[model samples]
Target: MINGRDPRIDFFRGLALIFIFWDHVPGNPFAQLTVRNYGFSDAAEIFVFLAGYAAVLAYGRIALRDGFVVACVRILRRAWVLYVVHIFLLTLLMGIVFVANNHVETRDMIQEMGLSYFVRNPQQALADELLLRFKPNLTDPLPLYILLLLALPLILPWMLRRTEYVVGLSVALYLMVPLFGWNLSAYEGGVWYFNPVAWQLLFVLGGACAIRGQRPSAPQPRPLKQQPLFIVCATYVVISGLITLSWKWPGLHEMLIPKAISDLLYPISKTDLSPARLLHFLALAYCAAKLLPTGQAWLNNWPAQQTCRMGRYSLEVFCLSVLLAPLADMANALAGDTWPMQVFTALLGLGLMMLMASGLELNKRLGTPGRVVAV
Candidate 1:
């Protein structure tokens, strides 16, 4: 029986955090094993979807018990916290990249990481950063998340009362993006990398799913394996796997995927959250849900539990990952991106993240004063 917190959410969120760390380190060999290589979607989808799910689980409960006003205060307060973290993270990342460049004579690090504007025009860049405009690469997701969380005050009430209508509105906004070229403006000129307009659909859907799961009186949804739609999802996952594997084996890929289909899906849009990526993540999520049902005892095993600890402290772990990325890059550049070095860098970075999570867990266990544990 599903009761209290679900371990699966933390498990997957932690796993996504790990993948995000691996993917951020450009030359890491382990990155190829991440979900992005085998599927249309990657850690970003998992992160955002789980964010939405967790938001509902956390703020939704507060709304139910304490009233909408209290929920709004809590949600908006959390958003403010995320905003502050983003600013600090951006400052720290710039510092890291700057120092790394000077030490290694890799001046292009700033430009390569998309922080050149700060170097070229500090005043304007500082202004843009304050306005949440000038986000460097690997930092885009936070602003998008901030916007979504800020909107939760309005979103959560509707989600609890008119779930379909709220989701329908989110989808309508998503469809309008492609039709009307809608997007939130970014630093200097371009649109947000993870366009919130389109991505909100996934976020809202995740929240809806969490709401459904929480209602004990409502009939539980059928298991994915029992559903006819599972066959289609599984088939899509298999085909995507084959297509991605083509990167390793070009000849086999050519034989597996026709040129016409490849051309049609080429440049699968991450900025717009393309349909292929969205559906692929949904399929992967369905399979995960089925395979790891609720309250599975094995989830409490040491490694899984440790990963869950990381998920429990996702914000801290994610901030650490962002900061560690440039350092990892510097290490890779210095040590040479040999297979051994890449593997070592990836392992070491992951170990540090685990260690940080462990420290936070330790804080909670010790009931340290002023240490707020996230739900």
Candidate 2:
């Protein structure tokens, strides 16, 4: 952990960011290998959970040292910055898609991007965009994250005092979503792609973990075989993996997952953060934590170092990823969507993302003149 910022978190975050970029490009073959292929949860879960973990760790310190008011202001300011970036990114995306639509003969980029609304109703679209409602493709997570950060001030104090209570409250709110259809408003009379009411539980759980991490160390953990909870988590992870992989073959999926069980777990909604999805993520996280120690030698390698740099400068890297996704899709489409072209675009995009990360690190080292504080 450099400067009290865990490289493990950054490494995982960077890995998830790469997954998000791949998943954003619809029909990209590389996306078939992402986390979603192995479980009910996807990279978005990791992104939101880590966002909460990082936000609380960064701002909670200010709450202790500078006072709660200062921390609240700082959190709000960061949220506002995210909101602005979302708007600006959306604007650029629309323009890029518009130009690409004309250039790409195989696909209609604007239609694929869900930008038809903006084309038809410019005035209303602009209004909704300002109100945080007009979310096109590849733009959902930022808005979801912005709202999560906005609400941090309210529960953050309670989180510092009693993280359990905050988690309980968050759980209660999440439960109400399925019971009462609670959700935030979105563009064109639809609810948010990511329901904040349901997702807050993950965010809160992440913050709870962060707060717990700040306390003194507990006893050394038991071995994997000796830990019953770890065993259960590991089993669930394996079961979920087989089930998720079975989805690739409909006959196998049906044979492997019986109607009785399928009925029980069907319609697993990412929008509402369904219970099965949540459990799968928690189980996956538990197994990953138990199996992978933070200080492994592999984590110090060249690829890992680049990924860690991408994680350290996550916001900028994420923005570049958002912009790069559709462009990568276009590039592949231009090459007739062949396997070779698909792999090329995917690798090229990752390389560009890594390059941007290294450039940012270099700029920070040369331009900044103070102690490197964790963001």
Per residue, candidate 2 scores C-alpha lDDT tens digits across 272-312 of 99999999999988788768785757697998988888988
With a 3 Å backbone cut-off (N, CA, C), the pairs that clash in candidate 1 are none
lDDT of each: 0.88, 0.88
Q: Which residue window of length 10 is worst by lDDT in model 1?
A: 216-225
Against the hidden true structure, what lDDT does model 1 obtain?
A: 0.88
lDDT leader = 2
Model 1 Cα RMSD, Å? 3.4
Q: Which one wins on TM-score?
A: 2
Candidate 1 per-residue C-alpha lDDT over 1-375 given as tens digits, one digit per residue, 9 for 90 to 100? 113577799999999999999999987888988999998899999999999999988888888888999999999899999999999999899999999988665446888899888888999989999988899989988998999998889888889888899988998999988799789898778888999999999899999888877767644488556777777888899888777778788888788778998888877899999988999999988877766668859786888988998999999999999999889888878876577877888999999999999999887876977666677
Local error of candidate 1 at residue 371 (angstroms): 14
